[model samples]
Target: MKKISPKELHERMQGEEKVLLLDVRVEEKYNEYHIEDSQVLCLNIPKTVIFNLEERDELAQITKEQPIVVTCTTGNSATKCADILDGLGYQVEVLEGGLTAWNEYRK
Candidate 1:
């Protein structure tokens, strides 16, 4: 999976880029604040235990060829999500350092 810094991701978002920015943090955290156009998909729950994987259906909405970037509080959760997506044959990337880095660099 490709890895990108938050600053670079922010710049891409500013431009006319068709990118899927995913925030893997919790819903409450996301409700507090998140980058523009970012979709929330928390990875705190165990993927194996969560049978209704298609609950959100965001994965189905997006094509595997699309540029998907995952982000969490500190990038670990996002990395895990990226791995799962990658294994499923999706073109995914992880935002290095995640939202923390983004907040530090951009805000």
Candidate 2:
């Protein structure tokens, strides 16, 4: 599994990197707060458990080669999802410290 810092992600997005931000929190949490920027596209795929196949299959609609960044409240859930996606041959990176890290960085 791969990991990326929130600051680096923001820098990359600022540079116009086409990265996918996959938020694994529940719908309510995702709606509450998330990384919002024009340069990066973000999608919410709630994961009640680690690597739900249904969600994974649904995400298959997107190209596998896309730079995918997985995030959650504390970064724990994203790890599981990242591991699963990596095993499936998708290049997945976890948001270091997850949303907390992002929130702090923005502050």
Candidate 3:
């Protein structure tokens, strides 16, 4: 899976790129804070629940061929998610250091 730093992702978003930004952190943590326009799909949840083929198809509603950027609290879970999506033939990228990195960028 490809990995991108939070700074690069931030710039991409600022440019109004039609990206599929996914927040793979837990719901509570996501509620506390997340990058604008990111959709939350907690990594702790079972993959069967979130990444089923049907679910992925549904997720494609937002951006079928667009770039997908996955993020978690750090970067591990998001990378895993990217691998899954990659295996499914989607273009996916992981946000390096995840939301922690994004938060740091904001400061």
Candidate 4:
């Protein structure tokens, strides 16, 4: 799997590039705070769902058209999710250090 830093993600958003963010965090956590921007399409699918569900319909909003960047509270869960996406033939990247790093970078 590939990896992307919070700085790089921020730069991409600033450049007006479309970003597909797959947040593997729980829905409540995602609703509280997440990467938001006009260029970003963020999906809040819990890590457990991604691990337990076989239906891709829940992930229908996301496509193989763009590279996906998965994130969680930390990098661990996102890494697992990225691996699953990679196995499923999608180009995926883990958000290095996840949202914690992102929050720090934003400061």
> In model 1, where do residues sit more than 4 Å from their true spots?
37-58
lDDT leader: 4
lDDT of each: 0.70, 0.84, 0.69, 0.88
Please write out the lDDT profile of model 4 over residues 4-96, one tens digit for every residue: 999999988887668889999988899999988899989888888778756566877777767999999989999998888788778898999
Q: After superposition on all CA atoms, how large is the RMSD of candidate 4?
A: 1.2
Instruction: Give model 3's TM-score versus the native structure.
Output: 0.75
TM-score of each: 0.77, 0.90, 0.75, 0.92
Candidate 2 residue-wise lDDT at 7 = 83
lDDT of 2 by residue, 5-100 (tens): 988898889785667899999989999988888887898887664355654556755677888899999899999888877887878899999999
Stretch of 10 with least lDDT, candidate 3: 40-49
Q: Whose lDDT is higher: candidate 2's or candidate 4's?
A: 4
Candidate 3, residues 3-66, lDDT tens digits: the string is 8887787677666445567776667776887676443222333234355656554454534476
Q: Rank order by lDDT, top first?
A: 4, 2, 1, 3
Candidate 4 Cα errors over 4 Å, as ranges = none
- lDDT score for candidate 3 against the true structure: 0.69
**What is candidate 2's CA lDDT for residue 85?**
76
Write down the TM-score for model 4.
Answer: 0.92
Stretches of candidate 2 exceeding 4 Å from the true structure: none
